[model samples]
Target: MKIDIIKKYNDVRTATIDFCSHLQIEDFSIQVVQFASPAKWHLAHTTWFFETFILKNYVKDYKEFDADFNFLFNSYYNSFGDRILQTNRGNMSRPSIDNVFAYRRYVDAKMQDFLERITDEEVIDLVILGLNHEQQHQELLITDVKYMLGHNPIFPEYHKDFNLIKDQNTITNTVKIQSGIYQIGHQADGFCYDNELGVHKVYVDDFEVNNHLVTNGDYLEFMESGAYSDFNLWLDEGWSWVNKNDIKAPMYWHQVDGEWHNYTLAGLQKVDNDAILSHINFFEANAFAAWKGMRLPTEFEWEIASKELNWGERWEWTNSAYLPYPNFETANGAVGEYNGKFMSNKMVLRGASVATSKNHSRATYRNFFNPTERWQFTGIRLAK
Candidate 1:
């Protein structure tokens, strides 16, 4: 059992390192948008997480790769110490691409050595948690890199062949869930984050949720119909955002010769109407849903429906704040800082995005972001 667990943990860590190997040195430092991170920073930050949380806490005689890394890569953990200012992460070009890879190797060697010698279940659990956390960042790596590269005049492809999903017709089967006492949030789990725990019951009124996500074609219709101009179709806050930002179309979308084309990391391609509509925030999603006489699902409704469905197509925005469960308590020490601090003032996202790892996603995995933020892989699932 010990060998199997350690091997599994090491495999995940190695895969993360290997994923970084695909990018060029130049690609590692470009933060074209403020919302995205440079790929090099992501590489260092994930390593910093393991070193700070698992290695420093548990590994006897463990030495940090760089003393300054604790300050440079620490992200939002006030308990861990002051984090590098988020906006300044792009300015960190000193840790050259080569150094970042070296940092990863140092962390990797220590992690593997610890895995080989350690047999404590508590330690194993922490390793598994770290591996999972890295996987989450791995997905972010793809999205962040894409966001950065897509902003360049010469849009570069992240992968040579842009064929993760094939061109097959998606089933438009809308599933109607009966209104009743439906339990939402995390239930059975080998491992779940703190926010997903305390599986609580939530009563959902009878609602219809689309089997698949909204398509670009559906979104385009809203655009062509002047949906953005109609204040009635938008929430008060959403209308304010639209008017303030003059958002006429989804981000990355541009009209050419009266036709819509979207700029992707793969360059400007004709909008794939069948592909799930992505890069829209909660406000836009809610506005689009309202335009169609549907509504965004509440977090409970989303969880209840998502628990029974395939969720990797897109991360569905929920009409719920990322608050604690009825009787939630923080974990001891710094780990407690994980989910509690960001609970208020953020909207919850359910399911996982297309770029997300299949293993990393769960029905209860609650992703949160500000409502106006659209840099992440966000989309909408219609509920009525």
Candidate 2:
């Protein structure tokens, strides 16, 4: 078991570097929005996570890699101590790209040494959590970099091999799930976040959900019907968002000479009608659903029907608020600040996406984002 864990650790760590191999040094610091972080920051913060959480606790007399890293890389852990503001992360021109890589190598060496001798199950659990946490950042690294490059005046391809929008929508039928009291949350005997811990029953009414994710072609029809201009299809808040931002289309979408195109990791290309829709926020997702005279499925419905339906092409927005499950409790300490603190004012998204790492997503995995966030690979699934 220990050997397997160590291999998984190396695989995840190496994967992070491999994902950034195509990125230039300039790309490492491109963070156009406050919500999205830079690739260099992600690399450092994930390393800091292992250094602070695992090594500091398990390794006796562990030497500090750099006393300043604790302040530079601490992300939202108030108990962990003061840190740089997130918006100011892009302003960090220091800690040069070379320094970040050196930091990763320094900490990874310590982690490899610790994982080999550590026999405590509790310590192993923290190591696993750290790996999962890095996996989350791996996805963010891809999406955040995409957001930066996509917004660039001259959209440049990150890599020709990186085709993130190639997944085609498969299921075309609506799956019927009978109303019942169903067990929700993570019930499996495996690693899961505290957010998925409160295993409880939820009563859902009979509803039909589309097995197929909404495709770009489908959304094109919505756009042709002038839904964006029609305030009736949008919720009160969604309408205000649309008008305020002049949001005529999904993020990264552009109309060139009356032809629809979108930016992908490989660069800008004509929107593929058959490809699954992506980069849409909850507001646009809800409005698109309403335009079709349907509604977005609740997270419960998505989970209940997930087994039978094909998902994972994109993170499907659910018509559910990000809230704690019954009997949910935040873990103690700085680690406790992980998911519980951000439960308010965010909507839940179900399934995985093209950028999600292998085995990183499960049926019960709950992804939350502000209603207006569209930089991530988010889409919609219709229900009634």
Candidate 3:
């Protein structure tokens, strides 16, 4: 058990570095937008998480790689220290990509030493948390890389030979769900974010959810139907976002010489109409559902209906607003900020995406984002 736990920890930590193998150092510094952090920042901040939370908390002789890194790499842990402004993450070039890599090596060596000597169950628990936290950032790092390269004036690919031809062969139809009371939220036998706890019953109405995610070909019809320009098809805020941004297609998508093309990690390729529609935000997903005379499934409906269906390729936006479950309690101190702080004014998404690492999600896992943020591998599945 001890050796396997260390091995599991090593594999996850190694994967973070592997994610950078495709990128040039220059590629590591672009934030692209405020929500996305520089690749360098992600690399250092994740390492900082280990150094600050585990090593510093437990290792008496540990020394920080750099004293100022606590400020530069701190990500929203206001209780611990000040954080660099999100808007300026891209602007700081001094930490140089090389320095971040060195910092990763430093923390990784210390982590190995600590793990070799660790016996406390509490330390092991925190190490597991760090591993899961790194897993979340692994997905974010990949998605952010796509945004960075895809938005370049001449669209670039993240990998030269790793083009993804997403397999999407499921029958595109809805499965009828009978009305019933259903149990929702994690049952706590396994690891889950705190927000997924407080499992409880909720009555769900009869509804039908798409057997498969909305595909590019399926979404193309909505675009052809002038969905973007139609205000009546959107929520009031959604309409404003559409007009304000002039959003005409999913992110990383372009109409080249009149045919549709999308940027992929493998590089720019012709839009595979059969591929599941991804890189869309909650607002866009909702608007598309409205255009089709359907509505998104509530999170409860999705959890109930997904057992017999295929998912996990794309994070499907749900109609449900993000909020606490029955008997929810925020963990005290820094851990408290993890899920509770951002519960309101956001919408929930269900399922894991191709970018999601294996074993990172559960049936009860809830992913949330603002209506307008779309950098993650997001897609649409309709319900009514």
Candidate 4:
């Protein structure tokens, strides 16, 4: 068991490094927006997680690679200690990409040594949590890189053949889920986030959801109908967001000579009408559903119907607000800050995306983001 886990740890850690293999040295520190983090920070921060949570707790004589990194790379665990402000992550140019790589190597070496002889189940659980945490950053690393490169005026390609968008034919068919009392939350024995821990019952009404995802062509009709200017089609807050940002279309979408083009990992390319739509937020997804005389599914509905649905191309927005399940509780320390602290003011997103790390997603995985945040690989699925 320990051998398999050690191999998994090394594999996941190496995979994160491999994910950024194609990037130029100069591309490592770009952070265009406050929400998006620099690639260097992500690399160091994931390393910092293992060091802070695992090595320090399990290894008696483990030493931190750099004492200052406790503040430089710590993200949002106020209980853990001081951390740099989220907006100022781009200012961390002092770490130098080489230094960050060295930091990862240092922690990885220690983690490998610790994993070799560790048999404490508590320590093992923490190690698994750290690995899952790193996987989450791996996904964020992709979106953050995309944001930095997509916002560049030159629209540079991260890789010539890297495609994050999956091409699929339009399917207008719907799957009807009958009303029933269903058991929800994570029941599997494997690792899952704290938010998915409370196994409980939920009553869902019969509803129909799309067999596939909402396509660019389906959304284009909404755009051509001038729904961006239509107030009644959106929620009151969504209308304000639309007008405040002048958000006429999805993020990375550009209008060229009356044709739609979007920035992809492969650089700017013409939008495929039949391709699945992505990079959408809950507000836009909700508005699009309203325009179609439909609604976004509650998280429960999405999970129950997900057994038969072909999803995994995009993180579909659910109408559910993020909250604690019945009997949900947090761990005793900074680790408790993982999923429970930010439950308020965020919406639930279900399924996985093209950029999600391999074996990182499951049916009950709950991804949350602010309604206005659209840089992640998010999309819509209509329900009625």
Q: Which candidate tops TM-score?
A: 2
Error of 4 at 132 (Å): 0.5
Clashing residue pairs in candidate 3 are none
> Deviation in angstroms for 153 in model 3?
1.1
RMSD in order of candidates: 1.9, 0.8, 1.4, 1.1
Candidate 4 per-residue C-alpha lDDT over 1-384 given as tens digits, one digit per residue, 9 for 90 to 100? 899889999999999999899999988987788999999999999999999988887789887899999899999999887889999999877889999999999998998899889899988988999999999999999999999999999999999888687577455678999998999999988999999988999998889998888889999999999999999998899999999999999999998898899999999999988888989888899999999999999999999998988888899999999999999999888988898999999999999999999999999999999988899999898899
Per-candidate Cα lDDT values, in order, are 0.80, 0.92, 0.87, 0.91
Candidate 2, 259-343: lDDT as tens digits: 9999998999999999999999999999999888899999999999999888888999999999999999988898899999999
Better of 1 and 3 by lDDT: 3
The local lDDT score (0 to 100) that residue 268 gets in candidate 2 is 92
Candidates in descending TM-score order:
2, 4, 3, 1
How big is the positional error of residue 85 in model 2, measured in Å on the Cα after superposition?
Answer: 0.7
User: Which scores better on lDDT, 2 or 4?
Assistant: 2
Clash totals, every prediction? 0, 0, 0, 0
The lDDT, on a scale of 0 to 1, for candidate 2 is 0.92
Regions of candidate 2 where Cα sits further than 4 Å from its true position:
none
TM-score of each: 0.94, 0.99, 0.97, 0.98
